[model samples]
Target: MPRAQQIRSRSISASPFLKWAGGKNQLLKDILPRLPEKISVYYEPFIGGGALFFALASQRRFKKAVIGDRNPVLVDAYQTVRDDVEALIEQLGPHAAHATDAEYFYWMRALDPSSMSRVERTARLLFLNKTCFNGLFRVNRRGQFNVPFGRYKNPTVLNPDLLRACSEVLQGVDIVEGDFEALAERAGPNDTIYFDPPYVPLSATSSFTAYDRHPFGRSEHARLARAYRACLARGATALLSNSDCEETRKLYRGLWVETVAATRAINVVASKRGQVNEVLVVGRRQSAPALRQVGASGHAVTSSSSLRRSRAAG
Candidate 1:
């Protein structure tokens, strides 16, 4: 399908997909253009809500691609949808029709995954996603989905067409449960890697989504920086999205960076949820335009060709 022709607002590329915090549904427009045309495959290490992969794939095809994530259930959801979307859709039905009450949310959240039918399991995943506070998939240390039920009166949980569409797009992808670094180890020439790790808070007061119970602290950030370095050294195209922070800027130092002022939907407080600045760091050179749009809230847009040029020089 033509790249532009396949892009749609409804019915995403994968079905039975989990609604994740920091999923890039909103960033697809900004990040889509930055992607290089000539590439063998696509790799998304932190494939939370695979907004990018599903969006891009809906319009194009890849020779090979790998979607990896730390959440085993999330990864498994993708795999099941890819293999059999219809069955998965069938599995997700109960969750969509579930009561939006708090009690139902807790009950579904605490269900035994082992004894449930595939349909029930799918429904539970969808239920947690829709009813979770602001579509956040936060699990406790015991691996329990613990977010509270949302405030929506009606939610679309088992979207058949969307799931089928997603299954079509996710066909043949190597969906695995692993660290992003392990996935990045093999990214080389003719490959493009897009990193969307759990967003570390730019400020102490701003941290909200704790994707994993284990803190993704400085060490994890350092590990990501090393992965970027590896991707650049191996001549693969790489792009990273993170909250705009001086510390993160320091982490991705000496790389071609572009700042896009975009609306951030995930926030506990309503007033601060309007707009936020995010940095899109790339490990290779590409011509990018300036000033996407003036967000409702104050945000900055900047470009760092130095990092891109450095990758080329190497």
Candidate 2:
């Protein structure tokens, strides 16, 4: 049997093990149906918690998958899960035992990842992710994991079955690190790329793009918008999700845009946590006319009517 068919035959089930900020799990219902009917190769450049990727993997939605993130630690975790899950599970046992110990959690977080083996580093990240504040993966300017320990009554630090399932689904998949634009450039006519980059901050103080040491500021957002248009020009369908702010709406003006409501779960102030509107932009393979209407420079030629605003439950 062909590799794709062999992969699908396994019929494995998996889900994201890490708790990522701005993860798409809540919005999967809104995002999945917008995917291309047929995907020859699936590309997800900003593979945060990989909620959508795992969902698609469960359904065997694509023949091949190329997923990446700029965060090397995140990529390493995925690689270790895919290439050495048994060892990873073994390494995680001790961390699981010490999940509730604040000293142990802080000690593990303070250790430099460069000094540890791949399995050790992956284990540390997994442990920190499960035990950290709000399950966040924030890093300092020096690239140190800085989130404080989360004293949950019971946190599942290790789940062998879930790891095994994720590993099985990731078989023959590519887990890459570095610039998202590089991965976007690899998309072709047969591929569908999903961009879930750190959202444009709703407000200056509300920015939480610090998944790593590098900041994703306005320039990076502009570059990503260009990359999205390039993917559409290459005849590859592209879907993106971001905050429903004026900047984002202006950036993807001519594309099919829809607003969906998602609950904010990670606010510092309890009173601030509530439903917020996010936009989903879809650019299909046959959207050349729309592209032309917007111009080759990707400037908005049309009005805001192209944006279809409606509130769907996240």
Candidate 3:
């Protein structure tokens, strides 16, 4: 079997342990082929669910990696998995035993994650995330997790093997919490940065960008585009994902922008959940050798590739 197939066979361990909204797992087929074969350092600023990171790790793609997210709880979970997986698994034992208990679920949800230890906090988040409505990671103005309990049958509260696998993959990864612009400080030549920021809503009532109190509005998008350009200026290869809207296209004007179908899995209305076109923007390649590698791969996507606008098959 091929390496990718081998990795997929260990689904329990190789795959993302948590279910995430706007996860890239479903789009990997449309993504992996486009990724440059050789990468030195990998960076994912908005590391929600980290599906791409995990997949790359499974393939042993990069030399070193740094992943960050604005959401502190998500960062804590990643840190706990990297540094204290065993303890986190232990902390989740009791919660797993009482997984289906609604009273325990609410009690765990109300318990402030800030007040707990690292392992306890991660366990709390994982339990609440799995039990919450559709596993939505939304918070209010005060940064409090407010999603209500979910309706599901026999949810997997804890998976020790998968957590262990994730921990192993995150061994050398530097996990951080803060704005996406932080990547500008760490990114260097030959580094690969994938930006999976909160998508600009497709419609007026479809706002789902609120991962925390700070919504990713137009200004944020513009700032991210600047950051992307800055990374490219420093000789880093960057790929970004966003809603395939006119504004997003305009924001990333003069870059490689292509549309791919992404399944809408997190919509409140079931009728609205289906295939939707999402944009994939690839930045300019600076190094001659890197450009050669892209050509060898046959994709040959560059800053000017946006002009052709290759339609990505979902």
Could you tell which candidate, 1 or 3, scores higher by lDDT?
3
Clashing pairs in 1: 13-166, 14-166, 15-163, 91-119, 131-150, 255-307, 256-307, 256-308
TM-score of each: 0.83, 0.87, 0.87
Q: Sorted on lDDT, highest at the top, how do the candidates line up?
A: 2, 3, 1
Where model 3 places Cα greater than 4 Å from the true spot, the runs are: 1-12, 285-314
Superposition error at 149 for model 1 (Å): 1.3
> lDDT of candidate 2?
0.83
Candidate 1 lDDT over 1-314, as tens digits, reads 23432354143535226666676777765776566644588999888888878755654635788998886677767777777556666666665666567777787777888787555565577768877788877768877777777878877666666766676677788998988888899899888899988776877777755665666777888999899889878978788988877777788776766776778676777787787778888664443233233223312234332222222221
lDDT of 3 by residue, 1-314 (tens): 24553364366555777777899988876666566667899999988998989977877778999999988888889999889887988899889887778888888878887778988988988898888888888888998888888867888988877887788788889999998898656787878889998888778998798788888898999999999878878878778999988788788776767677889889788898889889888764222122211234333345433222542322
CA-lDDT, candidates in order = 0.71, 0.83, 0.79
- Give the runs in model 1 whose Cα sits over 4 Å from its true position: 1-16, 117-119, 284-314
Worst 10 residues of 2 by lDDT: 285-294
lDDT of model 2, residue 310 = 37
Candidate 3: worst-modelled 10 consecutive residues by lDDT: 285-294
Best by lDDT: 2
Residues 289-311 of candidate 2 have per-residue lDDT tens digits of 13212334322233333334432
**Clash tally for model 3:** 0
